[model samples]
Target: MSKANKESLSVGTKIEYRKDFKDIYLPKTMPVIIDVPKMKYVMISGEGDPNGEEFARVSEALFSLSYAVKMSYKSNEVPAGYYEYTVFPLEGIWDLVDKSKPATDKSNLKYTIMIRQPDFLTDELFDRFVKRTKKKKQNPYLEKLTFGEIAEGLCCQIMHVGSFDDEPESFARMEAFCEEEGYVRSDYTHREIYLSDPRKTEVTKLNTVLRFAVRRFR
Candidate 1:
């Protein structure tokens, strides 16, 4: 191939989460223990059912900001460390506001939804992206957006296929795996990474990464 062809290929290549972070993003259906590293994200917090309008708005805001950073090179002044990368999938740290409610009760759910930013995204760059996104888009949830690092540390994760409502079956399997492996869940909250777009994919074809922090039995 010519040098120009090579350059085109390099620029076209995107860093895919499944290919680059297989242990974290692409796991087998069976639960496994892994140490998650700290990573940066553009995040927004909200409550109530994820199917509701608020959740949609929060997700939209996060993606808008993430894409702004990913496509910054198109702008006149690119970020110093900017590089080509695919926008990371949307992830959520989920919990319930009312402990008495079962996980099936979506109304009590509270969550922080986020999209992972590329390593080149700094706090300063994040602020600039947010500002640029706000000007380009009119999402009210933009004000709720924040940029930070999250380290999941030791955790158990599994790939879940099927409907989001069917996740408890996978979580149950994860709990059983942890019990057999001498580890226990460390918190009530759990994380979900959406690999397939729910709006576009069928319920039975959805792919999600289900994970929760864990530690060796005391």
Candidate 2:
């Protein structure tokens, strides 16, 4: 979209992914197949239990840089193709260090936490924002952040509403769906898009989008 067109658009227009791509974001309770196109994100990698302090610190660092970039555009120094938009929610791609192990053993999980960026953001722009954010405060994890595009291709996804510990119920349904549809779950671990803030939302009310990469069997 042109700058003039973006400017004239409503405040809601900034986040094209949220509005334009509901299949990937707002999936239904029943499993549905969708293709996730390539999209850019600011991501950081880490290991340990998700309920630990390290996970919290990693999340903080990502949000810090994301907010810095947003404020930069909103303030005096806006990057080219900058437009007003809502910040995307937190997302994670999780995997077990030992592929043989089940997901129930989460203590040794490896994860990449990320927040999506607008398509207009460039590598140079991302680096500048990183430096700008670092100068403001000292965060060792800042150096671990990487910006890149991920194309998850075809996936089966559903909206899971409940506590994190209760996700097994949803996973069971997804596994059954895969079996019924003749699709094999890929090695790629499940990806989660957090739609609710755990800090504020009740456990039973938590909203999470669960997705798994899959391939069809002949």
Q: In candidate 1, what are the lDDT values of residues 109-133, reduced to their tens digit?
A: 9998888888878888878888889
Each prediction's TM-score against the native? 0.93, 0.89
Could you tell me the C-alpha RMSD of candidate 1 in Å?
3.2
- Which candidate gets the maximum TM-score versus the true structure? 1
Candidate 2 residue 117 Cα shift, in angstroms, is 0.6
Per-candidate local distance difference test = 0.88, 0.84
Residue 184 lDDT in model 1?
99
Q: Residue 205 in candidate 1 has what lDDT?
A: 96
lDDT of 2 by residue, 1-218 (tens): 45755454435445655687788888988988788999999999988799898888788888998888776654455677667767788999988898787877878699999999877789998998889888986788888899999999988899999998888798889878988998878856889999999989999999999999989985
Query: What RMSD does each model have against the real structure?
Result: 3.2, 3.2
